[model samples]
Target: MLKLELPAKYEALRQRVRAFVDELLIPIENASTAGTDLKPEIRARLEDEAKKRDLWMLHVPPEFGGQAGDMFSKIVIWQELGRSIAIPPRRWAVFGPDPGPILYQLAEHQREKYLWPVLRGEKKVAFAQTEPGAGADPAGMSTTAVRDGDHYVINGRKRFIGFGDEADFIQVVALTDPAKRARGGISSFLVDTDTPGFRVVRQLETMMIDRPVELEFVNVRVPAENLIGREGDGFRLAQSWITEGRLARHGARGAGVIERCLELGVAYANERTTFGSKLADRQSIQFMLVDMYQHLYQLRLMLYDTARRFDAGEDIRTESYLCKYFGDESAFHAADRCMQIHGAIGLTTDYPIETFWKQARSFVITEGPTEVMKMVVARKVFEDFTKTA
Candidate 1:
């Protein structure tokens, strides 16, 4: 009974993002495949072009020079960007730096200093909440920050931090009081990447395209003004940001991967031959294609429904988990089917399907593991049922 319709404005936005990806980002990503790192020169060139087109930071608020899109609009745009193996659209990288918990908690001066520069792409920031010891449980983080007269000295290690090495600012969570834990002991801080004692100990090469970093903080000093929100709201704020981000990743990026997989499958089916006939003529191939289509359609509907609910200001904590679970699983199914249709070529780098497969597999673990997401959904369902009973 869920309505699957998109507003005309959002549809148009989708097309715009799709066009940019097809025309610009795709080529850049194609060129960067052999190189382990995204070339700074190439990135600068593409970012410049994106800015010229007013496509700089699509998710940031308009007051900060971004489009200020709603959740629905973001879902549509990010889905289109995720359709290719290329560098994500310029805005995608800016997502973490944009409006979320950070923006809402920014002091007036802090907003003007850090947030605005970030929106303009003059500075880059990355989330650094995950640690070597703390994967899913932020409450167990060992990172500690003790307040000094004018600054807070931090000491800890963070791992699997996305874009951490390249970021100018790092958003980190540390324990200020172990007794309060997640309730009132944890705090979030924005630390300059160049601050003394903050170092990139190692870079983790993920199965996916981006290489995140493992950072070491040795008595890193951060101004007291760098604290985001209240001293103890770090865990709550982090949870909200992470939950929303997980939904976006699953719904939008997963949809894009599914679409790309279908494209690869269909292209192969039409031309690939076996037993003197095209693969498209084979009943087995046709069935697989149909099944893939079913999964894609189902995922798309769920993504839109969840996005709409989020935009309507509904509490989507449980729905977000459902979408993440379904979106990742469905996309993996589509990618596997598409690779099967391509035979050996799909396994090779000659086509993008192999990369897509790897990326999809990584999604099954990122944000939250698939098993963890399912448990969250189950708990929510049980709680709701008990309340009604």
Candidate 2:
């Protein structure tokens, strides 16, 4: 049986998180952030506040001085955090260092050198996989890593890597066996930022206000021991990271965005007067609000179900694709409708609607585009449904 409702404890935790966002994050939502991150003073204060509430290190493991939060719990927290634009959608560290799950696959020695430093906030890591020709598909990647006696010489260019300029090391994905490609030829390597041939080419400007960097690796020799897992695990490893991201970041955050849009839209529609009556009184405005509410309801159910299944150790690759595209598209539509309802005020910085609109709009293309997600899901649909035929 599938349970959509959260457990008592989780529901309680969700309330706590929502309260934190409404009281703390929402009030400062309009304040200027420091380059996609919270300002030092603001971050310091919030960190202290979060610690006081025992809200710190929500995603980290218990052994690493974190709460070892579960998947559902993380989705709840992320959903609440999505309500405010004060926290950058992509780069956020106030909750503590999130080395990400891919690092957990590092070998014992690699863990000490890379993962431990990250857990201790002594280091940061950036994942490099996207290239000029590759965005969603890794089979077309052009980056190559040639194995030598003691090291692998990497040559590739990675684009749109978030926080690449500030990282201490990079989890670089390269073609280890050209014949296998994404099937079994790709490999992941940990390369130090100061390594001889590693260079950050430039920061790519984006409408989302987060500047992701482009990186160039020319004959970057990474020690053989730096390879994560086996030589042919790069594509799988990267996809695993991206898969969970679609669920937690895209799916959960989309639910939160829809909820927030509904909140803002309903409040304004009820209060703001139009040509003659309150915006809420207009059928056109009501229809948009209804649509936003419908998306929120559907997305929440799907996110909860998918997250629950994932927590139970189920493989949700196809479900994740469904959640990702539906969530991203829903949130964007909700934001667009909310903006329309708010009229010109929505576009101004006076309201968070504009930022929400922009962020939601960008999500439709970033993680996995809607069309790609739909294509993946369509394949699964045919696989499952045609089996009965």
lDDT of each: 0.78, 0.87
TM-scores of the models, in the order given: 0.90, 0.97
Across residues 1-389, which tens digit of lDDT does each residue of candidate 1 receive? 12456788886777778887788766665565334544667656766777776677777656655675577877887688788776632235623345454655577868776777776558878888888998866689999999999899999999988778888888898999989988899999999999999999998776666677899999999999999888998888788777667667676788888888878888899998899999999999988888777777887787788878888998888888888878888888888889999999889888877777887887877778789888889997788787652
Worst 10 residues of 1 by lDDT: 88-97
Q: What is the C-alpha lDDT profile of model 2 across 1-389, one tens digit per residue?
A: 12356889888888888887988889998784877678889988888888888888878878767885467887888898888898888875567888887997777888889999998789989988889899977678999999999999999899999999999999999998999998899999999999999899999988887899999999998999999999999989999889878987899898889888888999999999968899999998999988888788888888888888988999989989988998899999998999999999999989998999999999988867899898888988888888552
RMSD of candidate 2 to the truth, in angstroms, is: 2.1
- Per TM-score, the best of the predicted structures is 2
- Name the lDDT value of residue 36 in candidate 1: 50
Output candidate 1 Cα RMSD. 2.9
* Backbone collisions counted per model: 0, 0
